[model samples]
Target: MSLALVLDLFGTFFFAVSGSLLAARRQFDIVGSLFLGSVAGLGGGVIRDLVLGQVPSAFDRPVYLIPPLAAALVVFFLLGSVERFRRLLLVFDAGGLALFCITGTVKALEAGMNPAASALLGVTTAVGGGLLRDVVANREPQLFNRRDLYAVPAMLGAGLVTVLWHAGMFGTAAALGVAAVVFGLRVLSLHYGWHIPRAAGTWHGSRRE
Candidate 1:
């Protein structure tokens, strides 16, 4: 398969796994798990495609559905053992994020979008599914709250891809390199508790509801 397709599949699997884990944690039934996993796998790509004014690849292809369903099945059968797979999930998710971010930016650029708009589309592609998953699961989205270094990494990855593309370095290898760098930085951030601070005083007078 092409590198772009590979990246897309990888992203789908991890996002699906993340959603499946959440469903299992919430004690959702099999149907719920499948629905959640499928949504997580396709949600971002659908949004990305729509923003680009194209038909969603997820809807046009069957491979897009199979991986997430397979992942959900595995998670469902091994629910009690899911904790042992946490680190694995994080690694996959980070890699997927990097890949999706790069691909999103590249796709946007191909569609003649401006750099800023392309970068935003990339971030949306990377996090849209997770955001949807969180909403469906009735939990706060990590991108909106302090949890993990999520969107920042995607932004960096997309930004790098955009810069490289502008610099005439749009080869597949260059894109993969940018993705790797972003993924590495994200993993490091997670290990080191790196974070972007929220605006101070934005909630100065507010208390948790």
Candidate 2:
């Protein structure tokens, strides 16, 4: 398999794990966990592929379905052990975000998209899955959370990928380096409570009857 395929699969697994953990925490049934895991693993890629006018890999390729199922089973069976690690879901999410940004940009570039557009799509791919997972689980999306640094890190990683591709310096090592940097930035943001500034003052509307 190609390095790009490997990266895509790894991202899928990471995101699926995060989704599965969330489902476990929510006390979802195994079927529900699997469903959420699949959505989280494949949603972004599906969106990306659709935007590119291609069939979604999760449907076109059977291999793409394995990661989410495996993740669901793992989380369901290992709930206790997995729960011992604090913020484990966020860690996995960071890993997925880092890799998807790179792969998404690369795919868009390969499809003849301009660097600017490709970078934007990369950010979309990085965040789409988590956003869907949150909505499906009936939780607020981290992307819209004022105090979260989710999309910014994705944008940074996507921009870097675009730059490297334009410079003709994109390779396995460069890809890994960019992923590592993105992951570190996300983890650090979580640890330090970093976020972009929001509009000053909260909105207060008239109280509802």
Give the clashing pairs for model 1.
none
The root-mean-square deviation over C-alpha atoms between each candidate and the true structure, in angstroms, is 2.5, 2.9
> Which is the leading candidate under TM-score?
2
- Minimum summed lDDT over a 10-residue window in model 2 is located at 200-209
- Candidate 1 C-alpha RMSD relative to the actual structure: 2.5
TM-score of each: 0.88, 0.95
lDDT per residue (tens digit) for residues 83-170 in model 1: 7765655665676687789778878988999999999999999988888998999988877766478999898888888898899977
Please report, as a residue range, the 10-residue window in candidate 1 with the lowest summed lDDT. Answer: 200-209
Residue pairs with colliding backbones in model 2 are none
- Cα misplacement distance, residue 15 of candidate 2 (Å): 0.5
The reply for model 2, stretches above 4 Å from the true place, is 201-209
Q: lDDT scores for all predictions?
A: 0.83, 0.92
